[model samples]
Target: MRRLLGRDHDNRGFGSLQRGTEDAAKGQGDASETKGQSPIRHHGGKEINREQIHQQIGSLSELTITFLLDKPRILTDIQTEYRNVYSLSYLSDREFWTCSFNDNILNLCNLQGEILRSVQTKSKNWPYGIAVTQSGDLVYTDPRDCSINLVSGTQIQTLITLWGWTPLHPCGTSSGDLLVVMESVDNKNTKIVRYSGSTEKQSIQWDEQGKPLYTSLGNTKYLSENRNLDICVTDYAAHAVVVVSAAGKLRFRYTGPPSTLLESFSPLDITSDSLGNILVSDPYNDHIHIIDQDGHFFRYIYNCGLQCPWGLCVDSRDNLFVAENVSGKVKKIQYYK
Candidate 1:
């Protein structure tokens, strides 16, 4: 199969990029709110500012971490004949989901790469982003019709259709809300939209100074909400990991480490672990960058033998699953000791 990220790879251009959403169904876990100034009262009724506590905790110098840089041992590699695998998401600890390029199909597979069920998308449009809601339902975006669809049982239903903006990626948050990366119709404006079902809850487009939070163009911004409730995105166009507070305030942007190994950083998929650590794929360098919740650079997972690692997800146990784009293989790797 051709490398999905090859230089000569077909440029679908702005119109070629896909869209998707995941259900914020009730069940997996509740989303945390770490972006507020509300007072956190203890059992004895002692009032403490939540934001202050997080800042103090984040600044602690004694936070010990064992950086994992050795090659990640591949637990399993699932081979698929699909031309290009664009995304990987965990439906459960035992099973996960993946979507393909130029196709309207989504596969639910077990850890062994055996397809247990295959769900066809609603429209002929290609599915881009995918995520599992707390209730375990699948939600994805169809760029062809500018709609977000939900998969329940064998039925594919269009939950909502967007207008004026194109939704790029959809992620399920811990609070059972859905976060979507959207670009304006003209491709000059980008923002993150939070939704409860079909109702829009919040729109995160600009910083406190009213500057755009993300690059105004491209479809490479993937979304993930950290355990701390901070919104994390691997913005390929911006060449940085843009993180915002739970309340939509711009927190930090990590461009890249000062290393010669990376010539140009094109971060694609991103996910947060149980420890609140952010893991982002650096396929251009064949490695993954791990960072703290506060956007502090932690370490790199190098020599993992990962070739063009694309989609990334962390299972409940923190086991890292990587999709090797060119080889059409999904590798289950253990990165943390």
Candidate 2:
């Protein structure tokens, strides 16, 4: 049962973000060096007007740069009825859907932890993964039936069912598609597949060298597509966060920061912020890792009273929601300014 994906930390201290500086251009130098004129910036060889200065960050054209707060604090904590909260997905800025590993019930709760609505899986089996679509509908994976189901109002519809594979994690992409991490019944093969409704669009299984990208040990891989369209997966058995380009090319793998206190890096749930920064929950260490899109270590969120942090998701405002398995509480953390 240890490898069957059902699994079961503390604390608060401030962790600072080690901000890195980036040059405007590779060798062209800063435009501000010419003291007599207003500060102008160049992006992709195009001149940026003074009015757009605040809107741009580094090479990102339209993205507004946001910095981490000196002290990331929990805004509020929402208590749930689940004995162990497993997964959660943001339905709106004020609402989210969550489910426990042992229960078939999925609850839609507001920021105050009020259960405004609840739905049970049609199969009456616990959902291995849950995601909310752009249309504000619930999509979940039922490993017990090897099916991907969607909840549209009061109707529960089966989207897809597999014969030999069991879907574990489902993430709704920006392009209105779905990405799922699945494992063979024998647990000898693991892969991620993208689906356009019920039709399979892409499969990400092997690396450039043809080696398996994810561990076949268990169905514990949780994934999120970043703002830059990169698919980020936290492979618990691998003890690494594997990120790949939108085209399925390997980008990088982050295996925790150097000199960590935990015996092993156990990354469960993953999410990406507005800045394309990948946030992963390290429940074994009682912290969350904040890394840049390029896999650079940014900092750690350790002082936010996290214990057995499992599922993670960022709201539209970039505020983080962490599901603490042991406490049965979901903490809303404001990390960025």
Candidate 3:
């Protein structure tokens, strides 16, 4: 296995880089996985080569974290180290899931980022963007399938079939519902809608003036709500994080100060930590920004070698899991005091 991040690694241009996401169906490991470990696993006596992971180390800068960063869990046992999980989503209190680029769903050991066990997928396309409900059910969007599906109790079922359409992305809520941000009509009509298993529920696309919220940009994605009864989302076209009250009232906005780093970032996913610190994905810039509750730039975590981090989620322990679009790999960054 290769190291995901190392000081000696320099991201040479495209010709020298390896696409980190391997074929999930064939799988790249002989590690016996349990729930909460890595998404890739051992199959019958065969092993998949995951050695290409560390060689393409992308160049990223260090962020000034306000709070201390959590210690990364190191897997000593070679058979359970989940080094290539592409998505991090919790299905229950003691169980979470990770998937590889080729849709190998596995029960994972999250705190240390390990793989527990895996159930292969029927559909072989690469899977990303996972949304697990409160009741140990999983829902996710597959770019290849052009739809969202549910995975629970070893059964995979299609819930929503979307083609030629989808907003920024979909996220799971506390009530087992999905809050989806989608791009529509030439990217001019961006909206967030709640889905009760694919059925449309409450919506939050209108502003105070009742204008439909939309952006004509290719980089529109990600939505989240704060504990303080406010909704915060990223608007890549506007180059700002849009904030509104739960009742649709405009609260405030946060944008990084002007700089080359601040330019052309397609903000994807967002989450609010227990400290009321808001972290949003700036995938285009290969970093996640931690903003204060007052919407001020605090710091950037995992700043380099990130190629369009999408599918962002934070667990109960506040570990940030980011999905890298190009690499098709999900990396976990533990946050602590």
Candidate 4:
């Protein structure tokens, strides 16, 4: 597959943003020069450097601006039994798996939202994440036990037990491996680890210079691997969408849109489409932001009337599924024309 953002594209605007941020982080930028300019927008009132805004605008030229006019419609809204549905994954085009944070139950439901089969978790620990493995088995994480469990045809087994780390989210990659989001015992360190069965294959934590790649505050990091194997994460605490190369190298970070409608950009769940574009849920702004693989701001899905969109997933045909947390409903939407 072609690289999501072609290497030949002029990304100098983004490069300038990266350099300016690095300089600011190292205490090298002049404070007086930034005194009056409308500080470029960013999460948490931090000075969004000019380079960052320039880069975001520069990326718009490469995007299909007309796609925004293709408004997405809610094909259907299926109500569930749970009070709050935290996570969702597709078992097939006709079926899906969902975990209830309040009821502590894992459900296998049809497109009509009818419960086909239900299983209580092995422990009182609520399942925070869920995914379907290559073998069609269901895998989930129990934060209380720090264990990753697999369920095949009603038989539940412990696949891996994390000793010092806490697994928060689990996603199945196209290569049949599993990518898990984890946190340290103190919750001050967070990372993503790739596992082949029970053996750890790779760990992504720090950058080349050894600085932590993600914020180390909470276990709200949701992850999905793109078609090109770039690991995409929605960091709730950092208020940014962080993407890294398959080798765990930091590629780019996208802080939400630079619109006045947004006060804070807190991204929750994330998924990648067939075209390699990244879709992120921004409940704080009551809309979702779609960006290119290179982290360029594209457009917003606001006409769909989404409320507190907590979970996101894309089917094989590129159909988008959104979990509305407050109303206990799931909306199937179509964005591409």
Candidate 5:
């Protein structure tokens, strides 16, 4: 958000503040000129009062004035500029999948949260977690049914069933396989599973450590294949994102913070951009954390105002869509450049 929305300059409450800074700068300039070349007995303007200097100017200018602060501009008024509904490909160029702990039957809605169509399974299978395959099949985890349903053009078929209802996140992979994060019976432990045509291809977390790694992981729903078909886990518990071989070998980990936060800001869902960056739904922090393909923190993009961000993903056009579970609204974040 450092360029467009990042430039949040409000003239509110900033009156004489501007005049005060300018007056201080002028005083410093005058004192410096009076100090000849030797400047033995002269101390220019009693120093430039570094803290008082950044009263105006943008956040990007902080480093130009001080050596110890690079604070990001805080935010407000968060609403999508435009909204649309896709009857067939509602989530084609979009990512509207979301989850709920209440375990109610979730409906497919437009950006406005209008229920387009919903299928109430035999159980209150909370399909709060969902994803779409590249070939275009809607896969969702039914907490009640404890299964992943593959919804095609008009029919919803069972793809894979899980023993646990809290399958938190289920994502479709580029390789035509499904990556689902399996929550334990207690909803406190989790593991990632790969389903290839209803067959379990791999148990990413279980196989690696003979157990699970996540305490509250959600972003493991989606994944991009590493060079060797390795799998990566966006560890929400450790406050780090990790990568592993499809064979379940530790690859790399990303544990950096974005603009210095007070507490852990983990992701609820993860999706990749054309640039190979990881776009994560950071609900508590109210922003998407963009991680470069190499697993480095890039920058926060949209930070208008968000209410309980539950799910997020990037489309082919590089546009980002977020689903607010609490507000029951879907948002499309258009990228200007």
Candidate 6:
């Protein structure tokens, strides 16, 4: 398989050069896939041509087909007017929800950075995490009150309240379930819990070795459910991205890519694209890491003038909205063609 990034590879004006080949290969692979046939043949040790090689590569998985732009540019910079945008969730392509640190107000803003509406937490406390549901409702976690709250239209309701754990990040899954990352009040235990409404359906905390899957310290862990139903979390204390299967079994952990920056790998926010690619924000390194579902490091997205890129969420069309903590600007970046 061709490597997504190479040491000597130049990043300028390369998208158009590869698009034609990849698109053609994808079409061939899709046709062969529907018929349940292999694109490669073993006929007396025959050598495959370039076209056959492309088809064989494409047959691997559609999720691996990424139409990434050679030079990803920022579509617009939305001056959110917050002290610092700590969390971002897309309610729609034109509207999103943003909240600042230790702030009790959640502002719904358009692409032009106009505050269309605002909602306060049920307890008038800051929300640790925010997410948009499939039904276009807003869900957030209030650690001060140890509850998960839902905002529908003009009403705010407490959906789930914990006894000994404090919810840090709440992610709304496509199946209408919620994935919340919570830590024990004592700060000694951390786990990801799946909730169907207010009821606990599953918990993912221990690995196959009966050890904690995430570090016990740190409130920067954020999560997202991939297109393949895999749960991805960025463990700030652990300095790694931990992924698990839908059954809550540990799959793999990505520490960081090779030739990292001087600062340690400190991942804060996490999200997944429509192609099942995982995107992680590394504020310390001033870039975003794009990895495959199986934990392969593909490339880095840092050229769009990102400064302290903290909160990340992709829109319905896969356009990335990056909330820069220092600049207080929500940059709409088109990473893919």
- The window of 10 residues in a row where model 1 has the poorest summed lDDT is 36-45
User: Residue 183 CA error for candidate 6 (Å)?
Assistant: 0.4
Superposed by TM-score, candidate 1 places the C-alpha of residue 301 at a distance from the truth, in angstroms, of 1.4
The segments of candidate 2 whose C-alpha lies over 4 angstroms from its true place after superposition are: 5-66
Per-residue CA lDDT of model 2 for 1-337, tens digit only, reads 0366322100010000000001111111200011011111100011235344434545332232346775688998889877567788887778888987567899999988889999999998878888877667788888877788888899888878787777888887777778889887766888888877677768999999999989986566899988778999999879899999889999999998877665577788899876677889877667788888888777788776677777888876778999877667999999876
Residue range 1-337, candidate 5, lDDT tens digits? 0100001211221222223323433443300011101001100011233344445543323332232113332211223221211011125442243333333444555555445555554444434365656554466655444566766666667655555334545555556666666655444556677666676667755435565545442323334443224455555556666666666767667765545763366544556554344666655555666655556665664445554454555555555566554444466665323
User: Candidate 4's error at 153, in angstroms?
Assistant: 0.4
* Error in Å for residue 227 of model 2: 0.9
The model with the greater lDDT, 2 or 4, is 2
Kindly report which residue stretches of model 4 are placed more than 4 angstroms away from their true locations once superposed: 1-69
Using TM-score as the yardstick, the better of models 3 and 4 is 4
> Which one wins by TM-score: 1 or 2?
2
Task: Give the number of the best model, judged by TM-score.
Answer: 2
Candidate 3, residue 42: lDDT: 8
Structural RMSD, model 6: 15.5
List the pairs of residues colliding in candidate 1: 19-141, 20-141, 21-139, 21-140, 21-141, 28-134, 30-174, 31-174, 31-175
State every prediction's TM-score relative to the real structure: 0.82, 0.83, 0.62, 0.80, 0.62, 0.81
* Cα RMSD (angstroms) for every candidate in the order listed: 9.7, 14.2, 14.0, 15.8, 21.6, 15.5
lDDT of 1 by residue, 32-64 (tens): 122211111001111235456457665421231
The better-scoring model by TM-score among 5 and 6 is 6
* Total clashes for model 2: 1
> What's model 6's TM-score?
0.81
